[model samples]
Target: MPGTPYFSPRLILGAAAMFGMLLALGIHILGQRFGLDLGDLWGTPNGIIPATAAIAWWLIAAVAFVGGYVTASLLFSAASGHLPRRLQHALIAGGLLLLIAAGQAASGPSPVPTLHGFYNGIVALMLGAAMAFAGAHFALARH
Candidate 1:
């Protein structure tokens, strides 16, 4: 294992970031294909369509990546103990879902359209898995 490269936390972060960016792009493409006006999601008053939609999309993606990384870390850490990994992941995923639900309620409505809650939930799950795998690999490398 001398020349073998070790897994780094950065790899997980980078993977999450890339996934987020892809998600953002996919959303945009889907919006255009379905003829859905993303301008509304950007909160444009006159609906004249500013560049804010692009910016907002990217911001959402960034948040998704960070959220995924954190959730994964928490789940892995908790599961590495006596708790089952499935239980730990489920708990963290559920907690994130609840947080998002509360946030949606408090914010009145989601700024981004197109299955906002569901999309984010999926992203969180993906992120959590990525982080868990990365963490596990890194931990193994040390042993």
Candidate 2:
């Protein structure tokens, strides 16, 4: 029964950290891709607050992690036999591909700016993949 016990907290924390890193990195990259001054967020009085940003990042990370965990858990439960592993791998790959496509789409000329959207989508995809991987690892390890 050692492996039977689900390490929910560990999985959630690990996934959240991974998601946060990816989100920060993706934000930085999108800012660079399109001419956006990250520092500008500090120009105005309420534009940027280090503490606020950190809190926002943490909130985002936690949400992404929970979402990923739930998705992976559901998928794991629904899949039969070898299907879980295969589905997990496929979902990760598909998510990456969707992220790339979304990024490309966002980069295109549009009436509304999509830089943030593209970055968020990519970060979510990355987080989802991390979650899927964590779930698969736990399931396999326990099995």
Candidate 3:
């Protein structure tokens, strides 16, 4: 690895963020193509999310988990000297997922919370975070 150009961990994190966002979008689009109907429950009456919608959210959370896993793995491999171990990787991956979510929240107006209700966003966030944390924790596990 001598003579190889060195890159900052921040730069790697930024790239991971972009990669995670794109991965999330691609997964979402693929889900839609498969008739998942991600927005089907956007404005349901009485803030009720049916079984199908719950299933859809599960898929979304799965995608989020993959995104977080890939991004964190990429960063860990790219900057092994920076990240200490499993706990740090999990934390970093979770943070990267949150960064992706924050970027998504900032990109445009999301009517999900306003129209669908706050629980939708909360559920998505919690599921996504939990899965992402688990994914990252296992990504570098010795098995």
lDDT of each: 0.46, 0.47, 0.57
lDDT of 3 by residue, 31-59 (tens): 44445545667667788766766667778
Local accuracy of candidate 2 as per-residue lDDT tens digits, 1-143: 23333445455445534543444344434444444333333335765455533443444445445444544454444443334667678867765664575467446664324765455445545644564455444533443
What TM-score would candidate 2 get against the native?
Answer: 0.35
Deviation from truth (RMSD, Å), model 3? 9.2
TM-score of each: 0.33, 0.35, 0.47
Evaluated against the true structure, the overall lDDT of model 1 is 0.46
Least lDDT summed over 10 consecutive residues: which range in candidate 3? 24-33
lDDT of 1 at 15: 48
| Worst 10-residue lDDT window, candidate 2 | 34-43
lDDT of 1 by residue, 9-103 (tens): 55544543444343433443343333343344534687666554454444444444444455445433443454577876786576556455544
The number of the candidate with the highest lDDT is: 3
Q: Stretches of candidate 3 above 4 Å error?
A: 78-143
Q: Which residue pairs of candidate 2 clash?
A: none
> Which is the leading candidate under TM-score?
3
Give the Å shift of residue 96 in candidate 1: 4.7
Each model's number of backbone clashes? 0, 0, 0
Task: Return model 2's CA RMSD, one decimal.
Answer: 9.2
